[model samples]
Target: MSAESRPAIDGRIAELDDGQRRLLFDRRVGDAGEVADATRALLALVRSEGDDALFDFARRFDGVELDALEVPREKWGEALESLDSEVIDALTRAARNIETFHRAQLPSDVEVEVEPGVTLGRVFVPLEAVGVYAPGGRAAYPSSVLMGVVPARAAGVKEIVVCSPPGPDGMPSPVVLAAAAIGGATRLFAVGGAGAIGALAFGTGSIPRCAAVVGPGNRWVLEAKQQVAGEVIIDSPAGPSEVLVVAEEGCAQPAWLAAELIAQAEHDPDAAVAFVTTSPSLLEAVRRELRIGVAATPRREVVAEALSTRGALLLAADHDEMMTFAEAYAGEHVVLCTRDPRADRAGMRTPGTVFLGGASSVAFGDYMTGANHVLPTAGTARSFSGLSALDFLRSYTWQELTAEGAAGMAGPVATLAEAEGLPGHATAARLRGSKAGEETS
Candidate 1:
């Protein structure tokens, strides 16, 4: 295949020019100034107008007129009954796995005595309510319903509210509703986009406000999350989906590798995919296979657009270079198709999730691997993490000091407070010291 005709850029990572480097590392989600302004306006409208704003947005963005935002409680059961038995069974099994996995992630309360007469401890408290946004734009993500709600349920959250876009029938996909039922969602709403996010954050008359919103969506959803970050907690600023695969010369099959790239690319036109290898022959082979795979996929237009714009085939100088590049990129999903994946994975510390070996496709992780797929995108994996049960739990520390301990800490506290020009704090600390002394005397 000619280089010009290939979907992705082929180059050595060390030799990448300015444009190639920017394409690989500067792939941040493009939330333009206009988009941000629009998101702020939408959120403010929802905050002030409540359900009326949501109804208007539904007509304008979703092209649907809605009498109600919340789906009837009985509709969840009805949706489950309407689904195929196989789908119901699959959702049930996935929910079980997800619950089991998140249950294990539930943290134990911790108490410690670090010094004499000073006891410090922390307790995990589940949020009273949480909103889980399942995207219904390009596809209905029943799996996302399980990924978001099951973990919150396992974390002991009382109100697991699900929000998904309504289809032309003026309801979320039946499969999504079925999954919500299986995942034990307390409430479900047929609202979507920035409007849904706003309603969840600020509370409409019909939709209850959530303490935290957890899930993934398009740029508009991400922008809305940013605008309301101070009003409520968000999982992270999600961007387009991304994946990176690192393969050893003989460890990965070209066909399998191509399939993995296509899987991620098909997500959106901006979703990024990359293949890094030290072997020139393997890179060429995978490039050819990618061409073949993209040609036959149903979402070929999206896949091709993503690949042509953001995809890359990187030739690393050696194992060390390959590992370094993968860690630096901090892909949302990293697949180690190496001779010794276990050994190679030890060097990786930043990827949102890692799949060991060629057989461990990212698709499994996306669906039923019992791992949450709402991960940090772009390079945010460098600091953020995949959604987990902990996202639904908040921790606060408490400290108790005996009089002696208080007296001991008072001098230093007063010194620091006075140095920082907080006379009130210093006076309070000195009073504590004096009171302790008086009691001891």
Candidate 2:
């Protein structure tokens, strides 16, 4: 497991069948038995013992004992005051950008008339409360606070709560608190792990029950969310970061592409990164740059592990094949490093977010680009979109019909209902009509 000794995979996409291609492209976070068992136990403890279990697990797992479960309101003001002015300014700017971007995502109410005198529409309502989790084990993600809480606040969520593991000093990171304050979180908790997830799902003595939980974390946190999905809504199974790039040989710089892959790889050891291209020479060039880049990366060990385990370079027959493979891969982040990026972008069907050139780095979208970094990972992008203001809002639909509208369609409606073996439904529809056969007798 040395960085210099790490392996990089090369393959031909046409040589593989559907199953093999899917296996190579799969990004589902694999579940380990031990981790699952540990997560279940922690969830049970949080469910049964409430605040007592939160304190116990904080001691056992995070190695910090809690004087209290929640951070006081005064701590937020203290954090804002103590933080460096530059960091605060950056977060404030990021918050403003996030709010502006997500505000544009607000769903407009819809109303339509399907038939004469019949109207139908949908309306949006914000959830009462949502829990946002910012990771604390390997790094402090103040950016996560901005991504999660800003959208909820924009959607007009009444209560926004935040939870992060306590550092060795027995408090959440002051930087995280500053971001939370900037992002408009109503409450903060110095809690972490599956315990924090469970506390949000099932209310603890101190933690309020949330209508939804949204954030990114490690395997244990993801599993806890899965277990409690029915009790509370989860944004998505956003476990680890990943990226895939489809590049044309002449259009992209090998070094820039290699740096993009390494950037995502450094997020976690389980992250997936891949490249599909028509040029064999470009593939080799990128690989060579990766070797040089990993040497200088601060998180070299982490990037090395990710690239060795989950990274690949696939040779596509042509540009079309490259796009086909990328669409099938459904990476969380897809970079189109092609000469005609706008044209190629239209053909890409699945991805949490699409970055259009060597100049537009994925790192830009992760922090200050105003686009959300809380993307759907592990191929879930095929079905789930990245988190936006809409995730915090629920739509309730309504229908209205005049008696004339109901009567005009009674015969067809009853016939369909009777054909479906629901005679009672047929009777209900017919009862609104004044025509012959409308009477039950």
Candidate 3:
């Protein structure tokens, strides 16, 4: 299909026609029953068979016969030594920025007195172990390694485990190893897909079980994560990569807007991209620029498929309509190419990450911007958040009360407990109240 023939919705999003609404909002990431069943079987096999299951799956799925599952600690140093100086420098610098950013996210314990002699507070505790899964099927995401590991390390996680699908040589990409080392992963495993998640969730003899598993991957990885959710904490279910570019006339160059859309579209065939604007001329110019940009890209087929299917060109009636639609869409990446991007961002509510101005490219955020790239997708930005140091930490609240505070709370507590028909709870509160009153008297 031609670029002009791609999906387009015009008018106020609130008053969209049935077909237009469906086009704009019906992009649900439905679960494939077959995929779920396969993932369940894979997880069961990994749980029942352990290392043998990993080897079998490695050969069956990854097409590599692995002699061992865990990549040796020594190989990380060797990988760094073998890599080009430029690649090493880039990974090292990116790791540094990522650590610096997440270190700032480390939360402090909060305490406050709600009333006289009554204190309540929450303390943050880091998980002891975490699993970072770097996808190696479609591409080597060394950046994902940093995104997952650096945050956990900064949050004070002691055992940061890394897992990735083995390459043709039966090991993860050397760049991944180097990133793991730079990010301070304590262990590395050459495994991937549902099986890798299973190993991390269930803990085989070779790969230690983790308290949480994170990083983005294909559908199999997502399905596996969902199945093992209660066993270990998983990040938000990642859907196809997506971005929404909200622009105004003359605010951003048409080529720059088109490039942003194409950059997100190139991620996968199912990835979604949309350009929303109030200016008809700007929309047309972006359509034209997309035609040129899509033709020039090496990933032309993937970009074209994405743009033709899930991509959209939405023309809103006004700035209010544009921003309303943007908030409703709640896209994973929202780029505001408006006159005042900051003001526009301040009014918005549900964007995984908002890139301000034409100069703030999503590509920069994906790599060296120090902001984590692992973000909620499939409209999940409405409630979910991007992966961060906070995800690796659990918080618990504590309460301390003086005798007077206990006596003050007891009457209300006992009354509520009696109203709820829990006589035992009422008696417990009354007994505490009596003891505290007597002590204070």
Candidate 4:
């Protein structure tokens, strides 16, 4: 499709039942059989080809091939030394902010008295080892490295591992290495794509199988996580990034309107950005801002493609209708840069994270806002939460009953077991109760 001819949705907001609404706005990728077939091929290539397959595919797909499967440990120092000092300073500052926010997410020890002489409590402990996938071929999001690692460290994860694809230079980006060091990653692996995920899940020659893996990646990376998930835990398998901006006339500025849409669309060609506005003037102003602002961005092609393919400008009767659509749409990031996020938080039931007011952009939350960027996409946020310290830890419940307690409950247990026709279960419960009573007497 030509750029100008890319479908742009503009229509009156109408109330429809669940079935009708779904047909109109379902962003499910399974609906596109071609996309699914392509993904299947991507998965097949990696599983059959292994690291060699990954290298060839990366060259063909990302236009880069790497020689080293691992970044030399000494590169950590060189990466730091090579960085533009100002960028390092910014990353350092962002790391501190991210650390502070995630630290608060650290679970506190809880002990409670559920019953007399029964101490019921819970303990929070981090996983022994974790793998964080950092995207390397496209661009170095040093911020993403910090985003995944800081929380794992704050949660007291013992062994933190970093993995990413190599750069054009056939080495992992110096920025990624530097960020991993700053973020507290204990080890680094040069391998990326599905092979990296497999190595993390199964443990290859040099690397060990990680207990859980977390971070964002392309479709192949996402599929790899899903493939090996049973062997190891994984964060949500993400899809194309999306944003829904609910704007009101009073708060709507030209810059805010254009920036919010372009920000999400620039991430991927298939990504979507929608502006649901109630004001006609605000809509026109948004168009003007997009025309000017998009021209200035380095990633204008990506932004343009995203806006044209999946973009929308839905005219609503009022703010309530705008918010209602947003809830039903379930954006990965909802920029409620309007007035009060809390006032309408009840209206927003599905956003991964709410960036309220103009002070905080979607970028802020992704980089240093302490909120996890590994959020559910494609309306999955309705049931999933963004990644947090909890993602790095596991919780379990254990119970210990007193001998007297066991004896007192034995008749009920035996009765239920007998009702279920499990004679062995009933006998075990009865015998235990009898033994307890005899000992007590």
Listed per model in order, the count of residue pairs whose N, CA or C atoms clash below 3 Å is 0, 0, 0, 0
lDDT of 3 by residue, 1-441 (tens): 365435454334556687766655656544568889988999999999998999999999999988999999899999999999999898888988998998998889999999987899999999989999998876799999999999999999999999999999999999999999998999999999999999998999999999999998877888898899989998887767899999999888999999999998888777878889999899889988888888788888888878777888888889998999899888989999999999999998889999999999999999888999998887878888899999899999999987777777888999999999999998877766797564854
Against the true structure, candidate 4 reaches a TM-score of 0.89
- Candidate with the greatest lDDT versus the true structure: 1
Candidate 2 lDDT over residue span 62-108, tens digit each: 89878998999888889999998999999999999999999998989
- What pairs collide in candidate 4? none
Task: Return the clash pairs for model 1, or none.
Answer: none
Worst 10 residues of 1 by lDDT: 1-10
- Which is superior by lDDT, 1 or 3? 1
Please list the C-alpha lDDT of all candidates, in the order they appear: 0.89, 0.87, 0.88, 0.75
Best-to-worst TM-score order: 1, 3, 2, 4
- What does candidate 4's lDDT look like per residue over 1-441, in tens digits? 235423266555764455535533676554455544555665565556555665676576556666656667789879999999997888888788877888887877777756543456677788999999987654676777888888899889999988887766766788999999888898887767766777677665556668998888766677677777787888775667788888877775768767888888888776767877778788777777777777888987887877776777667888788788888888888887556666877566788888787666888887766677877777878888887888898876656656666676679999999999999999877776897554864
Task: Give me candidate 2's TM-score against the actual structure.
Answer: 0.92
Give the least accurate 10-residue stretch of model 2, judged by summed lDDT.
Answer: 1-10
Candidate 2 Cα deviation (angstroms), residue 101: 1.5
Q: After superposition, how far is residue 279 of candidate 2 from its true place, in Å?
A: 2.5
Worst 10 residues of 4 by lDDT: 1-10
Error of 4 at 158 (Å): 1.9
Clashes of 1: 0
Number of the predicted model whose TM-score against the real structure is largest = 1
